[model samples]
Structure formats: structure tokens, C-alpha cells
Target: MKILITGGAGFIGSNFIHYWMKKYSQDEIVNLDKLTYAGNLSNLRIVENLPNYHFIKGDITDKKLLEKLFKKENFDLIVHFAAESHVDRSITDPDIFLKTNILGTHNLLCMALKNRTRFHHVSTDEVFGSLKKNDPAFNEKTPYDPRSPYSASKAASDHLVRAYFHTYELPITISNCSNNYGPFHFPEKLFPLFITNLLENKKIPLYGDGEAVRDWLYVEDHCRAIDTIIKKGKIGETYCIGGNSEKSNKEVTYKILALLDKNEKMIEFVKDRPGHDQRYAIDFSKIKNELGWEPSVSFEDGIKKTIDWFSTNKAWWKSIKNGKYKEYYDKQYANH
Candidate 1:
């Protein structure tokens, strides 16, 4: 199978490329990334020279580029992952999120339908908005109530995917997954940011009394779940994939501190970002019962491995932290 992965240089996309290549030796993989601030080429350094793996630096918002690539590759499958995914960034600047997440997805769907390629739209549980502490976990049937600009854009993209499925009879599967953490994760997200911060003995920024809840899925487990959906999932269905391990932001921060043998005093409580979801949980039983898939890595184990990766790979992340990655954001998100 020949597969094209958009946002392949970002955290999950890069991890998925590695996972796909390793699991299916016969499959060919092409990576399309815009090399945004969060998308790092170094994430896929291991497979950079692989015979079946190809990388293209292009934005999904560019319809002409999509046309050219789709025509050239005639890919069998396209995994859509490109987006302005960070909520904080989205809050400060929403137009980029709208263009990249909504319009870019529309472009991909149009090209995929034209080429007769199966599409898998990668999304986030944030589209369901926040859950009260007692609220039932979100399932496939949950109505989207996006709060942040980021989730709103993702919600729009998800709706577009279903629209194409129902109206055009396009072959597509959507997965709304929980927070993911693992290797090659850019340092902006909580996991990488906290881990790298502790490595440098910098204070950890604990947002909103650290009580916002999140379901944490390891990156590898999420990748495996995507593969399962591609192979066995029914078209036009949405799957909720999660780690089933829920933790408050504070709890997670302390766990990282413990893993690194650091002190809790290092936490510096900060004002919470607007529209910070109080809680998020996923009912992944659909994927579990149907696909026989569940997260295999325990939070303890997965986090430990992640900490070790950041600890050892200082140079890789050091380059990102050395004002190089910040320069991109400075140019775009100049105000915030």
C-alpha cells in the first residue's frame, strides 16, 4: 500500500510514519509537511533514507500542491494530520487555524475524492469540548461543542469529513483521539515542555491550578489504533481512541517531576488559558471491541520512556530551543 501522511514532520505524524514503516515493510510512505514551528524534520531522521519513505515540504492549504502530489503519487490512502493544533496559539491567532484546519482539510477531501483514495481524518477529543467531572466520557455519538479556536477548527474539519462521506459517498474514517505524548514530540505540548524544562531545571508552568483533566494516549498506541482503523474500520465512521488513563495537569506535572527525580517546588502556577477544558475523557470501547485494540503502554512506563528520550537526545531538542524554532513563531505570531 502507498500512503501519504500530511503533517508528517509533527509529533504524531512523524511517529505514525515510523510505526507504519516498521509494521508494514511492503507499504510505501510519503510525508507531506509544511515544516511549521511544531513540525520538525529531525523527528523522522531515523527513516529519512528509507527506500519506501518520501518527504515533501508543502502546506496542505495549497490546493495546487495537493493536486500535483496526488497526481504524481496516485496514493491509495491519505492520512490527514496537518493543522495549527496548539490551543494557546489558536486562541491568540484563529485565522491560521481556520485556514489550515478547515480549508486545508477541504482541499484534501476534494483531491482524495477525485483520485479515489481512501481518507483518514485525524482529529482531537477537544472537539467535544469540556466534560464535567461526572459527565460521561465522549463516544462516537457525542455532539461537537468546541470551545477553543483550535477545537472549533478541528470540529469544522470533522464535520466536513462526514459531509463528504454522506454526500459524495467518499471513503473516509475519522478518529478523535486524546492527548498524545511520546518520542519526537515538539516541546510546546505539556509532555515535551515539562520534560525538557525539568531537564534544564527550569520551573514547570502549571496552568489553572493544574486541575484540567486530560486523557493521555501514548503516541505509539495512537499510531497502532490508526492502522487498525485503516485496515478494518468501516467507512463513514468516527472512532474515539484514548489511553484510558486520566490525570489532572497537576498530577501529570508531579509524575514528570518524579520520573526525573526533580522537586515539586519547581512547579510555577500560572493563569490558565481561556476556554481551558476542565476535563476530557474518551470511551474507546468501539475501537477496543471491534478492532481488539487498547493502549498497551501504562502511563508510568510511557512517561518514563519519554523522559529518557528527552534526557538523552539533548542536541535534537536543544536546536529547537536555541531560538531557531522560536524565530518561526516570532515571524507569524508576533503579538503573542
Candidate 2:
């Protein structure tokens, strides 16, 4: 099979590419990435010269380019992972989020419809908004009440995917996953930020009271789940993928600190993000029962592997920290 994956240089995307290449030797992969501040080619150094893998530098918002590539490659499958994902960045500049997450998604949908290609969209459980302590976890049937520009844009894209399925008979499957942490994760996110800070003996910032909860999944497990869904998921259906590991932000930070031999004293309370969801959890029974998929790595094991990766690959992240990442941090968090 010839497959095309957008945002293949980003964290989860890169991991998925590696997973797929190892699992299917006969399959060919075309990786499309815009090489944004968060997207780094260094993540895919292992497969840079693989004959079955090809990398293309481009943006999903470029409709003409997308059309040309679809025609040229005749790819049978597409995994749409390209988007502006950080909530803080979205709060500061929502225009890019709208263009990338909403319009970029629509562009992919148009191409899929035109080519009648099978497409899978990677989404987040954040679109369900905050859950009450006793509230049921998010499922495929959950209503979307996105709280931030990031989630809102993803929600809009989700709607577009479903609309295409109904209007044009597009073969598309969507999966809404929870917090993912593993190797190659950009440092701007919670796990990497805390890990890097702990290494530097810096204070770990916890937004609000640090009670905000999320369901955390290892990126490799997520990649496997996506692979399962793409191969066997019923078209026009949405699935929720999660670790079933729920923890408050405070708890997660403390765990990471412990792993790094640090103390809870490093915690620093920061102003909460606007529209920050108080909690997020997912009911992933659908995928588990239907696709026979479950998370292979435990939270403790996954976090340790992630921490070790960040610790050993300092040069990879150090370059990003010193370059465009610093500017992005300054521009996005300047007000905070």
C-alpha cells in the first residue's frame, strides 16, 4: 500500500511513521511536513534514508500542492496529522490554528473526496471540554464543547470530516485520543517541559490549582491504536483512544519529579490558561472491543522512557530550544 501522512515530522506523526515502516515492509510512505517550529526532521533520522519512506516539505493548506501530490502519488491511504496543536499558542494567535486545523483539514478532505482515498484523522479528547468528577468519560457519541481555540479548530475539522462522509461518501475514520507523552515530544507541552525543567533544576509551572486532569497515553501505544483503527475501523465511524490512566496535573508533575529524583518543592503555581478545561478523560471501550487494541505501556514505564529520551537527546532538543522555539515561546507567552 502507498500511504501519505501529513505532519509526519511532528511528535506523534514521526512515531507513527516509524511504527508503520517497521510493521509493513512492503508498504511505501510519503511523509508531508511543513517543518514548523514544532516539526523537526531530526526526529526521523533513523528512517531518513529508507527506500520505502519519502519526505516532502509542504503545508496542507496548499490546496494546489495537495491536489498535485494526490494525483502524482495515487496514494491509497492518508493519515491526516497536520495541525496547530498547542493551546497556549492558539490563544495568542488563533488565525494560524483556524487556517491549519480547520482549513487545512478541509483541504485534505477535498483531496480525499476527489481521489476517493481512505483517510484517517487524528484528533484529541479535549474537544469534549471539561468533565465533572462524576461525569462519564468522553466517547464517540459525546457532544463537542471545545473550550480553547485549539480544541475549537479541531472540532470544526472533525465536523468537516463527518460532513464529507455523509455528503460525498468519503471513506474516513476519526480517532479522538488523550494526552500523549513519549520520545520526540516537543518541549512546549506539559510532559517535555516538566522533564526538561527538572533536568535544569528549574521550577515546574502548573497552571491554576494543578488539579486539572487528563488521560495520558504513550505515543507508541497511540500509534499502534491508530494503525489498528486504520486497518479495521468501520468507515464513517469515530473512535476514542486513551490510556485509561487518569491523573491530575499536580499528580503527574510529582510523578515526573520523583522519576528525576527531584522533590515536589519544584512546583510553581501559574495563572491558569483562558478557557482551560478542568478535566478530560476518555472511554476507549469502543476501540478496544472492536479493534482488540489496548495500551501496551504503563504510565510509569512510558514516562521513564520519555524522560530518558529527553535526557539523552539533549543536543536534539537543545538546538530547538536555542532557535525558533525561543522566539515562539517569547511571542506566545509574552503576556503570561
Best prediction by lDDT: 2
List TM-scores for all candidates, in order: 0.96, 0.97
Number of clashing pairs per prediction, in order: 0, 0
lDDT, candidate 2, 1-336, per-residue tens: 999999999999999999999999789999999988889999999999999899999999999899889879898999999999999988988999999999999998898888899999999998888898889999999999998999999999999999999999899999999999999999899999899888888887789899999999999999999999998999999999999899999999989998999998998787888888888899999999999999999998998899999999999878877887878766644554
Q: Looking at candidate 2, what is the lDDT of residue 122?
A: 98
Off by over 4 Å in 1: 326-336
Q: Which digits, one per residue and each the tens of the lDDT, describe model 1 over residues 80-164?
A: 9899999988987899999999999999999989987899999999999899999999999999899999999999999999999
**Candidate 1: C-alpha lDDT:** 0.91
TM-score of 2: 0.97
Q: What's the C-alpha lDDT at position 41 in model 2?
A: 96
